[model samples]
Target: MMYHLLPSPYESQEINHLTLAYFVISSLDFLNSLHLLTHKEAVSDWVLSFHLHPTTIPDPNNGQFYGFHGSRTSMFPPDQTGALLHNNSHLASTYSALAILKIVGYDLSNIDSELMLSSMRNLQQSDGSFIPIHTGGEKDLRFVYCAAAICFMLNNWSGMDKEKAKDYILHCQSYDGGFGLVPGAESQDLHVTFIEMMYHLLPSPYESQEINHLTLAYFVISSLDFLNSLHLLTHKEAVSDWVLSFHLHPTTIPDPNNGQFYGFHGSRTSMFPPDQTGALLHNNSHLASTYSALAILKIVGYDLSNIDSELMLSSMRNLQQSDGSFIPIHTGGEKDLRFVYCAAAICFMLNNWSGMDKEKAKDYILHCQSYDGGFGLVPGAESQGGATYCAIASLRLMGFIEDNLLSTCASSSLIDVPLLLDWIVQRQGTDGGIQGRPNKSSDTCYAFWIGAVLKILGGYDFVDSKALHGFLLACQYKYGGFSKFPGEFPDLYHTYYAFTASSMLEESGFNSLCPELGITQVAAKGL
Candidate 1:
């Protein structure tokens, strides 16, 4: 049902066939059924055919772009003048090809490594970022991460100037502690001229959203943790103070809900006028903000004792429904597996089972399991890699494992381990990258989403580490971050996911990730 129809919206993505191949074949490998694939030798040949050898191009300048095309369609007939046509190699496609070959058990020895490396080197820009294939495209962290992975895989660093690349990556860091897509651009300099130009059009400079702050905090903090440079945070006390302010307190508010939950930022409205009755309304908290708030606090080594655990726990309980699912707050909004996971993480961090009814929560989670043997956002919805991870991690955090699920429900296991393992492993497609759902293009973020589930399931041994390495390398941009899929531009979201996923595989040169918390093992120590 998933294979035949590429939706009309996806017609343009036809060039991504190579990426699709990597996803399917690599997924098969993860399932320990690569041998099930027929015509393996022929597939390998097809992938190799995309490789653009420098020798084939008459112009030396064109040779610099030699690698692999996204698909044969990228090929064009020779021009009337017989000069080299402009269809050049793509870093992403080359990566996909290499990874697929390796998954099919072919060493890279047969390819012209020297020529590919030469082309790859030429993609490096003066600013240490990379453009996927040519000089005209936007350069950013995604391509840089891809370049690093490619060089690492081929056992050559000659392709990129690592020091300069490192500098460009650092430059992308904004004043707010997050790396933006462009260096220095994410930061708002309230320059007098610029301020005068749009003073009336802008919101107050002092007003920034808390969720945005927390996200930036996570990126900066996690990046430092990954680099083992967390010790550089000399103003740890100030950082901790900033995080603690998000906490709600009873004494500070006039209502019952006060101090029972932690809102994302300052209250949306002032405290109820002392006379307000039943279930105080304004300034509700969110599960995501709570998780981020807690994680950041832990990362900064704040004393957990300072938190009103009892009230927080009480608030957490209030968010639960009879079906064992969780809502982010009392305010109406969509509920799903994500909030459940956050609530579970909160209780786990607090070391209190009283926060939630584990049995009911477990039941709700079981209800979310889809027919495909993976979990979805809600019951009977499509299975997604991110939702699946949230479901499984919530279970694990609640102390339910394969054995526990079987024993507690004896009549029926809450989770079907074997079936789920099969489903998750099959997420990897022929591209050597994993997708969130069936028939979707392989995305880089699923590396963590599905990869973490595999970690919890004890299925890492069944995975092809080398194949994943190759895909991640291929997804790298000439810049410093990773993209969501091959041939796509990189973004911070995918870049972080790539780092965490590589960490899960225990890839050399990456810090170990705490699967439950989604942070480096070192970062978890602050808790």
Candidate 2:
């Protein structure tokens, strides 16, 4: 069955051909059925074809890993001199390729061990974590394991810094003793099982269901703006009024330092009626909802100056913790890169920076940058897709980072641009969709989250836009909208991001987006 399936068309799994080949060949070898395979030399040559050889002598500092391609599609054509134009060599594929070669009774010594080993060192980061490829990938234990396996197979320790890798592995151990894929992440047992079992179980991309209504409204409004179809809303005033009704108002001019946030409620359910004296019973204003509310208002061409800007900005200060992180609400909530982003967007939309301390917030955002050049939700956590977006977008909105940062002052920039570029470009898998983190399947939304970061950093040109468009087309529902993954139910959240990502790619019938604001340039200008 496995042998028959090998040659059959696996369009969706084409990028994983080498991995699939390993499973079949290793399994057959274990069953003592290796003799059943004919054309042993042909199979060896087929596997060898994926090897990425350096045109010149290996320079570990060249930042290109001379390993093996995962599949033919990932391998680019060679130049006139028979040198590869681009190296898409991946460590996992190299390990699988070597395993298949070994099982086929091929002489491992014949391979250029020195070139492969020396170039492999380029993938290891300063913290001792190994990205899967030299182009940039997630730094985690999976790549470390693959590197170790490759070194073991080659009997060469020159490829990796073992002491650094050891330190990284040690950091991945959680308080409960089990190791995570990366440091400060959850233990692998349940986490890995769920990831393995469910490709459709879309994790809540952002936390808090309290703001679901507002988030949906933002998606609808912003998506309409992106399509240049905001004029389709016949009752634009009614929509604006309804969104503004969620705003919390103070009976009197309150102290700016009163430790109370006056913002917008997420939904009508969170709005409470006033008592007999007209004193409000509850104030459930949230930062995320406020951001969404303002975004909706801006898209509808509402005059933001008419609103109580001073009250909103002054009271918002209460949500900013001393460390410069922001809680979404005045009461309490998880303070992370997400809320900081919301706060920054809100301030940007309002044209007011008095709400939060820019210097303090900038300092806080800097702390969230993980060693791999991607930002996590909080300090010391594993880098994530959404958090990385928040950090970069927030910085762009706050004016701490320049637009097209890579082109401007990357050398003197506060953040590490080169590593960030490497990490982001690697998110685009061979399938064309972008994953949020390394070693994960691509999703529809990350095309915006991570894609926006690339646009801001001037690294957007590095992405394979055609492949990404193909992936997005696959996720499109026959009825309408897009699913988180292909062949699943479509949701507003994913659909909105898909539209924005498509716009960034210069898709027709869509307006260009202002990446930092997550809205159209026209809408942002109206603010």
Candidate 3:
């Protein structure tokens, strides 16, 4: 079976033919059945044929990865001068080829170890991720593992930047104490599909209720705006009116000292009926919902100045705690970076600052930065992608931080720029997708959540945009929208962020986004 061609079912996997051969030969060796194989020299020679060699002295920076082709098809024909086309050499295939040679007891030293190791350096990205091919491929843990295996077999450390790779592996550890295939991704699990299906089918009741309908509306409206297709939205006025209806307006100018918050309800279910005197029986108004409502209104080209800005801003102050952290709702909720961001975005959009004390908010945001450089949802919490975005974006919106701080006096910057950059750049997994926290699966939402942070800090170029594009394409739904993870169903939130991330990459047909506002630059300018 090892000597024969793979069956028809494996034709689609022909690109991985060398890997399949490695599996067979390694298994036979493990089973103590290696003696049954005849013509070992022939097998060794066949595996060696896949090795890519440089025509001249090896140039690691020549933009070609010299390794092993996975199969004959991947090994393109030589040029007119008879020089081999080395473009298709892959790290994984090279590892497989090397293992096969060792299994046959071939003299490993006969191979051009120096050339192989030097050329392999071409695949390592600045963030310590390794692309499988020189021509570009997913940079993830799998490729990193393959590179390590290859180096171990050849006894060569010169092939890669070991310190960089080590840092990348360390970053792959998730908060739940397991290593993901890539940084900021969830730990690998065999039951991921089943668990994801269950999550979609049977969401927690509390979580289901916590799904702010107004936020969903914001995602939809903002996505449309980003796509430059807001014109596709029929009855624009009606949409604006519906969003406005969610607002909790006071009969008169609201007192900033009032404990009650006059904002927007997350959904009608959370909106209490008014009493006989037209007073709200229960002020279920939430800051998050209010932000989403205002964002949607902005997207729909509504004049925010026409709304009750004084009442909204004054009542909004009631939700801000003395610590400068804000609860999502007047009824009280968790005080964290998320709500602080919401408050900041709300104030920025309204062109008002009376809602919260900026100095206190800035201090609160500064305290949330962890020793590792990433920001957490709250002070002293684990650094997270979303929290980092919330912290940075809030500061940007409030004018406490400048755009491209890394380029503009990073040393004097309030946050630890270097550590933050180190933490964030590692979030780009081997698959090119960004994860929100360490060891979590790369989700579509983080593309925007984390990508925006990079953009703000002038570190967006550090991420592998090509790899990210591939990941986004994989997660794209056949009909429309994008999924949280590839091969899953799509949702409004992920789809919206996917659009914004694409826009950040400067993908054509997408309107430029105002990262701080989470809206199109055109819509933000309307404010």
Query: For residues 1-527, what per-residue lDDT tens digits would candidate 2 score against the true structure?
Result: 87667555777888988999999999999999999789889999999988887665656677888899999899887688866667888989999999999999999999989888888898988767788877786778999999999999999999999998887786566545677787535422222233222222334753455446776778877776776666667788998898989988877556767777889999877887767776555778899899899999999999999899888998898999999999988779899999999999999999999888999998998999889998999999888889999999999899888889876755535788777777888899999999999999999999999999989888788888768877886786655567899889767778789888988876544688999989998889994
Q: For candidate 1, lDDT tens digit of each residue in 138-227?
A: 688878887887777777777789998887786566545688665534322211122222212323442454335555466556655554
Q: Sort the predicted structures by TM-score, highest score first.
A: 3, 2, 1
- Please give the CA lDDT of all the candidate structures: 0.71, 0.83, 0.82
Of the candidates numbered 2 and 3, which has the greater TM-score value?
Answer: 3
TM-score, one value per model? 0.56, 0.60, 0.61
- Candidate 3 error regions (>4 Å): 1-211, 252-254, 277-279
Query: What C-alpha root-mean-square deviation, in Å, does candidate 1 show against the real structure?
Result: 20.9
The true-versus-predicted C-alpha distance at residue 471 of model 2, in Å, is 0.4
Of the two candidates 1 and 3, the one with more favorable lDDT, higher being better, is 3
How close to the true structure is residue 41 of candidate 2, measured as C-alpha lDDT?
97
Q: Write the per-residue lDDT of candidate 3 for residues 440-516, one digit (tens) a residue.
A: 88988999999999898877889887689779877866556678999998666677788899889765446898988
Model 3 residue 173 distance off true place after TM-score fit, in angstroms: 34
Residue pairs in clash, model 2: none
